[model samples]
Each structure stands twice: as structure tokens, then as C-alpha cells.
Target: MASNNTASALEKEQIFGLAEKEMEYRVELFNKLTHTCFNKCIEKKYKESELNMSENSCIDRCVSKYWQVTNLVGQLLGTNRPPV
Candidate 1:
């Protein structure tokens, strides 16, 4: 039926809209995290243009801890269920 089709189309559109928004939010969060962690963990500048071992370790830990906290906050907020 035309009415059913319309309803279905609207539902799909809403789902896609939410997905788009979520993707945008994730990208923004990743950018923020990258900038914040990089600034916090990498203080030295070198001509080699490569992260030293300590810097690499600090960055890894920083990103991991950031996501851990993010996930915890998300859980507390009861926003979108945590991934399986």
C-alpha cells in the first residue's frame, strides 16, 4: 500500500539520518582525541619527523585510556548501547 510504503521510507530515512549523525560525531571525537593526545604526549620536536619509542607508547596508552573513559561515560549516559 502507498501508506505503508511512505511509512517505511520515512523510517529508513530516519535510521540513515541517525547513522550519519553518529558517524559525524565519531569522526569529530576522533579528531579531538587525536589532537588532545598528541599535544599531551608529544612535546619534543625533531627533524627526523618520527615519534620516538616513548612518544609512541604514550600515544597508544593515551588513546586507549581515552576510549575506555569515553565508553564508560557513554554507558553511564545510556546513550546508544555499547557494541557487542
Candidate 2:
């Protein structure tokens, strides 16, 4: 009984660890994707001029639009309930 309890606790800890690692990985991936997409969408002629008012505005719009699309797709997928 003691051994069984220990094994169950170990399994739970392992699952929790796996979930934490997965969340970290997802955060990293999101950061990378955001950075790459922002860079590609907003071209910079020079370092100093990269984020002038117009450029900042454009970047903001692009980011907003991207999030909107992502949310829409997520909703669609959630409703469809695709096999996991």
C-alpha cells in the first residue's frame, strides 16, 4: 500500500513536471513567432528609424489583426472538436 501510494505520487509529480515544461515550451514558441512575424511584417530601413510613429502604428495594427485571426481560428477548432 505504501509503495502504491509512492508510485501514484511520483506519477502525479511527473505529469505536473511535464505540463510545466510544455507550458514553458509554448511560451518560448509564442515569443519566437511573435518576434519573427513582427520583424517580417515591419521592415526597418535603419535601426534608428525602425520604430517611428507610422511604423509603430503599422506594427500595432498587424499584431492586432494577427491575434484576431488566431482567436477566430481557435474558436473554429474548438467548436469542431478535432481529434486530439
Candidate 3:
């Protein structure tokens, strides 16, 4: 019983570690995406504090393309599982 408990504890620890790693990776990806898309889509720096129509449309396309590529790569790699 003690050995079983130890094994379960180890498994839980491993799962938690993996979850943490995934969260970290997702955060990194989000940051990169934000930087890349903002640079690519926002051509003009406006002082109005809100995105213009063109900027909003560009950002929409940028995010859509990003996810499309990510999903395509995931499918090609046979790891087509949806993110948690």
C-alpha cells in the first residue's frame, strides 16, 4: 500500500510538472505572437489609443493565420490533439 501510494504520488508530480511546462510554453508562444503580430499588422503608430479599422482587420488576419499554421503543423506531425 505504501509503495502504491508512492507511485501515485510520483505520477501526480510528473503530471503537475508537465502541466507547468505546458503553461510556460503557451505563455512564451503568446508573447511571441503578440510581438510578431503587432509589428506586422500595426504599421502606423496612432496616438488615439485604439486600433483603427485597418489595424483591426490586419490583426484578425494575423491571428487567424497563426492558428491555421499551428494547426496544420500539428496535423502534419500526427499530434493533432487540441490544446487543453
| Per-model TM values vs. the true structure | 0.83, 0.58, 0.85
Ten contiguous residues minimizing lDDT sum, candidate 3: 75-84
Q: Candidate 2 lDDT, tens digit per residue, 1-37? A: 9999999999999999999977886687578657856
Per model, state how many residue pairs clash: 0, 0, 0
In terms of TM-score, which candidate is strongest? 3
Off by over 4 Å in 2: 1-4, 7-11, 14-18, 21-25, 32-36, 47-50, 79-84
> Each prediction's Cα lDDT score?
0.84, 0.70, 0.82
Model 3 quality (TM-score)? 0.85
Mark the 10 consecutive residues where model 2 has the least summed lDDT: 75-84
lDDT digits (tens) for residues 1-83 of candidate 3 = 99999999999999999999889878877887798799998866566788889889999999888878877777877885423
Ranking by TM-score: 3, 1, 2
- In model 3, which runs have C-alpha deviations exceeding 4 angstroms? 81-84
Per-residue alpha-carbon lDDT of candidate 1 for residues 1-84, written as tens digits (9 for 90 to 100) = 999999999999999999998888878888888998989998756646788888899999999988888888879889763321
Give the Å shift of residue 76 in candidate 2.
Answer: 0.4
